[model samples]
Target: MNWKGVLDFLKEKKFGLDRKELVEAETSPVVPDDFCAEEVVYEMNDMGEREAIERFVPPTRSTATRKPPARTKGHSRGSMVDPRTNRAITFASAHEWRCALILLASPEIAEVYDQPPAITYVDAEGKKVKHTPDYLAVSRSGKKCAIAVKPSRRVEKSGIVDTLDRIKPILGDYADDIILLTELQLTHERATNAESALQAHSCRVQADCDRVAVIMSGINGEVNAYDVAKAFGDFPRGMNAIWCLVYDGIVKLANPALMLADHPFVFRVLQATSVAA
Candidate 1:
C-alpha cells in the first residue's frame, strides 16, 4: 500500500469519499490511493513552496495511542546553617579537628604569610579526614607545615616517638614544606607514631604553655599583621618554638579561621555556651 496516501489522508483528515447516492449510487467508497495522492499534490502545490513542505509533529491522541504522564522524583533538601558569617568564634570546639578549620580560615598569622595551601585530612581507611594544620610559616630560607604543638611538659623520648608516629604521615606527606612545632623536642627517630604523639601530649602542662601564653598575649589579635618574631624564642635541648607548626608559606593554625573569618566559630561557640547558661 502507498504510505504517502495514508499519511496525506491522516493529515487532511479526509476519511469518507464525497461520492454517495440516495438509491442510484447506493454508498460512498474509500477514496482511491492514486486519486488521493494526486489531490494532495495539487492542494499542496497550490499553497506554494514553503507551505507545501509539511511540518512534523508527534502523533497526538486523535491520531495515535497516547501514553500516561511520567512520574518525576523531586529534589533533595538544603542546608539550614543560619549563616554564621558574623557569628562569634566557637573556642570550645576549637579542640576538635574539623570545627577548628572554621577558626583557621581567619588567622592573623595567615595575613603575614601567603594563604595556606588547600588542606585535607584522610583516615587510614581511605576516608577523608578534615583538619586545619596548626601552623604553616615561610621565611627567606624555605617553608614549613606544622600539624600540632605539644606543651613542653609533654615532651619525652617516648612522647616524641609516639608524636611522630601519629602525625609524621601527614607531615612527611607534607614534608620539606613545613616545620612541626611542639613544646617537646624529639630525636628524628622518636617522632614517628601515635604512641609517640600521645607521649608528647602527656608532657604538656600549664607551665609548658607559658611561652605560648606570652606570645599569644602579645599578638593582640593582629596575627595577620603582627611581627611573629616577637613570639620567637629558643627551646631547651628538647624545647620547641611557638612558630613550630609553621608550614609552607602559610602559617596554619588550630584556629586560623577564628583569626581570619569575620564571624569566627569562637564567638558563635561562646554565644551558644552563653545561651545555654
Candidate 2:
C-alpha cells in the first residue's frame, strides 16, 4: 500500500489517530538545531572565589594559659574531652586526670583548666618559690579554686600539703581558694560515679529525660529509683534520666555505694553525705 493508504488503514484499525492527525504528525517531524562546529566561547568570573577563606579566622587553640609539662619516666600525661564544654583537658598524672573527671562531673564547676600558670610567692623562709597547681577549677558562681592533687604517699614526702598550707595565703592572690586533694579524696567510687555522671549528662534522648523529670516532679520524699525507671516502659532509658537527675544534684542517692539501678534517692533535696565529689 502507498503511505496515504497505510495511514488510512492505521486509522481504520483505531491506532489512536484520524487521517488528518496522521498527516500532520508525518509532516511535522522534529528538526534538530543547526550545528555550530566552531569552539564555544566561555566566560569566567571570580565573584565568590576565596570568599570562604577571606571570612575564615584560624581557630585559637585553647584558652588554657599553659600546656601540660612533658611526660617523664614514671609520670603519666594525657588528655580527655570535657563533657561540659567538649574540650580537651590535659593532665600530668593519672591522679590529675581523675581529679579533672571529678571536677568536670560537678554541676557547680564551670570549667577546669589544667597546668594553670605558675604562682610565685615567698615561703616562710623568705625565699621565693614557684608552685604550679595541677588544675584551676572555676565554679559556676565565678569562684576560682587552685587544686593540688597528689597521692597520699607523696603528699607527706613531697610536703605538698604543707607547701600548700604555707603558700595558701600567697596563692589566695591568684585563686579564691587553694585546695589540696590527695588519693584519700579521689576514691574509686567517686571516680566511677563521676564517669557515670559524665555519660548520663551526655545522653541526648529528650523524651526519656522528660519522663524522668515528670516522675521526679511529683516526689516530695524518698522513692525507689527502679520503680520510677520502670514507669518509662523502657527501663534503660528511664534509668538514664534518673542518673542524669542524680548527676545534676536534683536527687540524692541514699546508698550511693549501690549500683546505679539499686539506689533509692530523695528528689530536689541535696544531702550533705552525697555522692558528689
Candidate 3:
C-alpha cells in the first residue's frame, strides 16, 4: 500500500484527526444518533406449555458503547466550557448570546425561560386569533410575560414593528402582562435604531401603558465596550430592552427560527439566573 493510502486509512479511523480532518476524511458518515429497528424473538421448549417455556429476551445494549454526554466535547459551539463558577461572560452565536445574558443578569426571568414562546394574539383579518406564546413565565407578583428570542444578526426584514403588532394583544387587559425580549449582536446604532422604532411608533401615556414590557439585549460579551466606545460610547448597544406597555401596547416582530434551549451555554445561563420568585 502507498504511504498516501496509509494516511487516508488512519484518517478514516479518527485516531488523532481534528474536526476538519475527520470531516474531510469522509464525505458523509452515518449519523450515529439515528435509531433503527432490530428483530426480537421469544423461544419455547418442545413441551409447548406456557409455564415450561423459557422467556425470550431482547438483546441488551452495552453501556460501554453508549454515547457520552454533550459536555464531553470542549470548544464545540454552544458548549459552556467556562471553568469559572459564574458565567457572567460567554460567547454563543447559534443560540444568540443575547438570550443567555438576559437570563444571566435577571434572576427573575428564569421562571418562564423554559416555555416555548408563541404569538398568543394575531390581527390578520381584523379579528383576534389567540395563540400561546412560546414563553408564559410568571413573575413573583403573578404577572405573565411573553418572551421571544433571536439573534440581532437575524432580525433582518421582519422588523420589530411586525412582531409587536402580532404580540401586542398579549398585553391586553385580560392578560396579566406582556413582555418582549430581544437579543441582538449588532452595532450600537443599529441595535438602538431597531429597538427605538418599535415603541416610538406608538404615542406616550398609552406608550407607558401596563402589563407590557419590551426587553432587549444589553451587550454581547464578544464586543467589549472599549472596542465599541472607540466609535460610539454613549450609543453602545442597548443590549437589553425591557419596556412596560402603556399605550395600546405597541407592536413588534420577533422571529423564533433557530432558537434553542438545549445548548449548555443557554442551560447554564438559565440555571444561573433561574427566577426564584
Q: How does each model score on TM-score?
A: 0.21, 0.68, 0.28
- lDDT, residue 179, model 2: 85
* Candidate 3 lDDT for residue 137: 47
lDDT, residue 147, candidate 3: 49
Model 1 TM-score?
A: 0.21
Inter-residue clash pairs, candidate 2:
none
Cα lDDT of model 2 by residue, 79-134, tens digit: 77675565778877878877987888887788888878888877768898888888
Choose the strongest candidate by lDDT.
Answer: 2
Q: When superposed on Cα atoms, how far off is each prediction in RMSD?
A: 35.8, 24.5, 21.9
Question: Compared with the true structure, what per-residue lDDT tens digits does model 1 show for residues 156-202?
Answer: 63244344444556665454443334423332222222122222222
Question: Could you tell me how far off, in angstroms, the CA of residue 159 lies in candidate 2 after the best superposition?
Answer: 1.2
The Cα local distance difference test for each model comes to 0.29, 0.66, 0.32
Each model's total of backbone clashes: 68, 0, 41
Error of 1 at 102 (Å): 25
